[model samples]
Target: MLNNMLVKKAFRIIRRNYGCPGLDGVSIKDIKQNYNYYINKIIDLYNSYTFGRYPVKTTTITDYNNKPRDIFIYCLYDRWIQQILKLQIEEIIENDLKEYVFGYRRKLNIGMLRKYTKSFNSKYILNIDILGFYNHINRDHLNKVLIKNTSISKEFLTRIDLSFSHLSNGLPQGNVLSPILSNYYLAGIDSMFNSKYARFSDDMFFAINDLEEQNDIINKLVPELGKLSLSINFEKVRLFETNSFK
Candidate 1:
């Protein structure tokens, strides 16, 4: 599925969006210097169906809380490859997900989220964030969800599976493929909460009948999320009156 034409387009998209070189500090211009070479390398990696152990630059940044957070960076070619994979799978996964899942989906935004949540017409709205979402997703569960929900080729699946060899958990935050995989895994939450639910990435919103039902959902979410090795960020959790949202 990693072909020359698609890879070339992926390269152009990367160049247009790029701000800096990655991992090895290799710029998109540097990649264009021997574009075919990088393309060949990515295509061969696909044929081999093995994780290339591609390099990612690691750096720390201060988050809103003034705490340090480490983010991963991938080289231009790796980003190209990831973009191709994302192009292949995101639509399929997005279609499988509910309309309320607003994150990383095309043609979706806070406006759409608001419209959908309002449709529930319930008495309250609960907003809760998952703790360390991108960094805490279990790799094994991610693999399972991706395979179950996507129809990618065996070779493509192997390339993803092989990637798990480098790390035991978490989707690296920077790559395009990370969103596709992460969104699909969180589909469990979408399924578990059938209606009156909206999720924009890790932030989940639920429309509730009252306090009793809200507590019951929260109580249930703890263990269900625990099954995925994830937990709620209680400090950030908020319950709002329906009109407050309106």
Candidate 2:
């Protein structure tokens, strides 16, 4: 059951933040003006186990490189739902996630990656990029992974499936919950390798001593990724030796 206090907190946070209205044209002001009505509506939807789909609007923003990057905006109500789901999912999977996952979390970045690598005395690094990672995530595969990682009720699973079914091909970027979902989806890959590895979103770094170990990891990973409709970007694969260790 969704906690009322958490729901209220989620609503309060979204109401204060400035964002463009979603497909339904429900602005933050509108939601605030009719806060009670909106709250009732959200509760009713939750009770009925039906979440209405929201249309995505695309807009471009300049990235750190000063290049335009496209971002998807979903309905405010949908965003609120995402917030709730994110909290729930995080609580469920937080303890189970591998330390190698550093994306979307604070104080876990390149420095931590460096420390992990040095501790393992890794001489060679294999950096891998998954081609079209979010677009290629198979829904069925994700469902199985979710079920395996946590205990969820059938009703909750149905609602989750309905939410994802609206996405069709794969998870969308710019959603609060997407990063966590992507991390969990790739957890299987992390579990398969004993070699030192770390991931930040779709980019993965594997530390090994020789080409043989690299090949061994790749050969095993490719087929596993294939099952989830994900593939490696052969063109982006780079192997480099650590000068100090080399």
Candidate 3:
């Protein structure tokens, strides 16, 4: 699925989004100036079966909560490769993701999420946010998940791993591939709950018909997530006994 045509498509994606300059300070305009050379360079790297790490640029900004959030940016070629990988990997796994796993996907949105939550109409809504989800991704288990899917090419999987070789753990927060990869990794949560929940990225939530099941759920999740080297951010976890989904 990844080819020269797909590489060109990735370029189109980067340009359409007006991708930001990374730590190297190379912009889309810079690439457009000598577009063919850069395009061939990307092709050459792939043709040689090599994927190299680029310095990630990070800037801290105040999120909506007024808390500092670090946004990561990769070099131009790196972004292109990531976009290419995203497009291919999405084809392999997108349709297979759980119905309530709403995050970073083109087809699902907040309206559908609200409707799903409303359909529950349970007595309690438990909101559980994984702490620094992107930062804490278990690469080994993630690799396992991707590897188990026999349809994905080994070369493709190798390139994806090389893209993140610099990080001992965690996926880069700003990379194009991170969102979908995170979704794939956390699909275990949906399986754990038998899809009785709504998750927007790592913002995990569950609607409970009985308050008694609340503690049981949390207690079970604690150890289950640990199997993947993950832990709940207790500070961000909360339980609401509500009459309605709102």
State the C-alpha lDDT per candidate.
Answer: 0.75, 0.74, 0.78
Q: Model 1: what TM-score?
A: 0.85
Residue-level lDDT of model 2, residues 21-140, one tens digit each, is: 678788877877988898877777776766747677778787432434556677877778767776667767766678887776656776676567667667888888888787788877
Q: What is the C-alpha lDDT profile of model 3 across 152-229, one tens digit per residue? A: 877888888877866788897777888889898987777778645888877777888776777888899889888878
lDDT of 1 at 89: 71
Error of 3 at 230 (Å): 0.5
Question: Which ten residues in a row are the worst by lDDT in model 3?
Answer: 60-69
The 10 consecutive residues of candidate 2 with the worst lDDT sum are: 63-72
Instruction: Quote the positional error of residue 202 for candidate 3 in Å.
Output: 1.0
Model 3 alpha-carbon miss at residue 22, Å: 1.1
Q: How do the predictions measure up, each by TM-score?
A: 0.85, 0.84, 0.90
Clashes of each: 0, 0, 0
Pairs with steric clashes in candidate 2: none
Tell how far residue 191 is off in model 1, in angstroms: 1.4
